[model samples]
Target: MEFSLPDDNNNLSLTRFESMLKTNNVLFFDSNEFENIIYHYLENGKISLAKKAIKLGLEQHPTSTNLRLFKTEILIIENKLEDADKLLENLHDLEPMNEEIYIQKANVLSKRDDHESAVQTLLIALDLAEVDEGIADLYALIGMEYLFLDQFENAQHYFKKCLEIDNEDYSALYNVIYCYDFLNDNQEAIVFLNDYLNGNPYCEVAWHQLGCQYVIVEDFDKALVAFDFAIISDDTFVGAYLEKGKVLEKKKRYNEAIDNYKITLALDDPTSFALLRIGKCHEKLGNDDLAVQNYYKTVHEDPLLDKGWIAITKFYNKKKNFQKALFYINKAINIDGDNVVYWKLYAQINHRLNFIEEAERGYKKALDLGNYELSTWLARADILIALGEYEASILNLIQTAEFYPETAEIEFRLAGLHFTLHESSKGHYHLKNALLLNTDYQYILEELFPNILKKPSVQQQILNAGKTEN
Candidate 1:
């Protein structure tokens, strides 16, 4: 809803228009003046005012093409596309060469999910366009239609053409880079950005994009240089400072990273992302107090950001303060209960605190949230076994085997649980599979089923598997 205020000329016209409205005076205005007034209302998101202006303008100048076009635009905005399209068709018959008419037609086609037709209509508009700016706009519109088709290559080509026509079109530049990223061609992006920077050396956006490309290619040295050039081009560029800090962090220069992150804090309001990165840098430097303070600030700035809470929880967990870790992780879960990582952390913290039932529930929630990691499955199954829910443990292991059939860990755990339940045939069957997968993982028997390992038949089977492997 944010928009620019009316300039002095427009302000005079707006004041006159409003005064006329209040006094119920049918004041006269030129078609151009009415257009400016309607545009001002539209720009400020006063759609009803704009519609009223259009009605009044057309009443005074019923043959005004621009006013009628504005009416068509409003109809389109209201999703009365059929009315808009009919109006556009009539307008096209009146002025066949009007680029705006073709553009509006393209808009209607796009809204109807007919993107191919939209692209063709935009091409027609491009042909009618006389000015460089209008041609660039049509190119951008065609690029957008290609994006809706998921044709990144075609989108990239058209967006590149738009950027070539207007080097200052940052959105087109972004779309070109996005297509490159989707295609995983960082090298091409790097080369293209470099060539662009040759002519536009002071363009901060291009430099930032080049830096990002270097980061993707793992060329930290070049990335740092590119970001530094971006900062030189625009000292107020917060993104450059952030990317520079990340590269420094990768190089283990934590002090430099903290300094760069702090610069971002000074340039703008304390962003949660900046605060979080600062905390991580502090933690790396062993400034535990400062790290915890910034972490608190991060969550205070943006309570919905789970990373801040997770950072504090992990910081406490690393210090073996399970109570504090559990406290913070609970806050994180309350903020985003569906996050798989949060639930996994909750399970771990609860398990560490011997809150067995809560740990089991947390693990189950994690699984329900689609955390299919082998470790998550094993931890949940182990908790079930400890709680004497042998059947549940077996069921969990069986499901885990589906996701990771080749893992010796799942087979061995299944063997151990079956043997504990006195299901000797099933236990032996799984044990044989586990040995065939990896005889080196026999230590699982020592840890989880020491009694089963002591059986003469199991020992003889292991010896025979080892000999067969030799």
Candidate 2:
């Protein structure tokens, strides 16, 4: 039971209600007007005010089913499922043919995580609902319940049914495509969307979904065609323009990608993603000044956009301006302190600047934040080795070896560490395994342990290992 105040007098009623509240006058609203006031408070999340309104409404019209249903909705929202269920059961007995009672019951069941029962209850509501009264919303609710249960096929079926009932149900249409994608049935989605487009060729959303499917299958050419049609159908569709730009970027059509990204800016307010993408395309095309300008605009438009900050950081790093890189990366870390990628970049920048201790701390923070990249581990170990912490470096490398079990590079690094620690037997054993795994990594021995490479015993061990391999 959605309450809607008459549009013509709605403002007057609201003004009168506010005036009554200010003056502490008795709120003498009719039942429908009270319902509207209560729903306005509820929709605004002012639960206390909504409760007051409900109390007043029930006092004035104790038999109002709509006020009772609103109370049940509040109970469900507050997670008082047992109370909501009892109220809804009574409402069902009182108004046996009321569609909203079933809908409210379904909502309570959904909050209780009994989504299958929720769907069944909503089906009852569907039967009770008139053809023109919330049928599309009922279908959408059933589809959402099925989605909650991970029954993608059933969800897709109900969402498609919703689309059939209301052609303007774009959310349901998108959900149907989402369910198909979740089931890895892109072919079926593409076929169904194509048929839909035959009847509704100007639907930008359908063309966008088709283009996305083509991209999933790595058919960039077909994706381009679909996106072009999407743009032609609706030139002001910012999403279509942005997606077309992405496909062009993937195909290395930098100038074309830039043009599409520019179009998105022209059609709507500049998005962080669009600004960053434009910067990347310009950078690819050697328009360095333009790239920097757009990258600056990206972070300016949305200060919390971590990708924009990261792009600027990488741009400066590529130019060997470590100071500027560090500045931008720190800004990113400030916004998203737990981001492992930002910590990794921070560590790399500090390492380049010879701030060994700071770099080590940054690496540790990155590892703590779940950075399992092979390079991150290797870099951390290298930093420890540079700081003359042979024992710590060996422990770090050993931990890394657990993640990358059969890597010759790790074995070679371990060999160097052991030899540096004067553990000759452990060094010899690791050297043997290293050469056996990959003899080419023998070159790393000199780079990591220059003194040990000149030792005749080490040279003989390497030669012997090579001979054994032959």
lDDT of each: 0.91, 0.89
How do the residues 1-470 of candidate 1 rate in per-residue lDDT, one tens digit apiece?
11234588778889899888889689988888899999888888999999989999999999988899889889988999999999999999999998888888898899999999999988888888886557777888899999999999999999999888889899999999999999899999999999999999999999999999999999999999999999999999999999999999999999999999999999999999999999999999999999999999999999989899889999999999999999999988888889988999999999999999999999999999999998999999988988989889999999998999878988888888898999999999999999999888899889877888998888988999989998
Which regions of candidate 1 are displaced past 4 Å?
Answer: 1-6, 19-26
Model 2 poorest ten-residue lDDT run: 1-10
Worst 10 residues of 1 by lDDT: 1-10
TM per candidate: 0.91, 0.91
| Per-residue lDDT value at 285 in model 2 | 88
Badly placed stretches (over 4 Å) of model 2 are: 2-5, 43-46, 334-336, 353-355
Candidate 2: tens digits of C-alpha lDDT, residues 133-240: 788899899999999999999999899988888766789989999998999998898898899899789998999999999999888999999999998998898888
Predicted structure with the largest lDDT when compared to the true one? 1
- Model 2, residue pairs in steric clash: none
User: After aligning candidate 1 to the native by TM-score, how far in Å is the CA of 157 from where it should be?
Assistant: 3.9
Candidate 2, lDDT over the whole model = 0.89
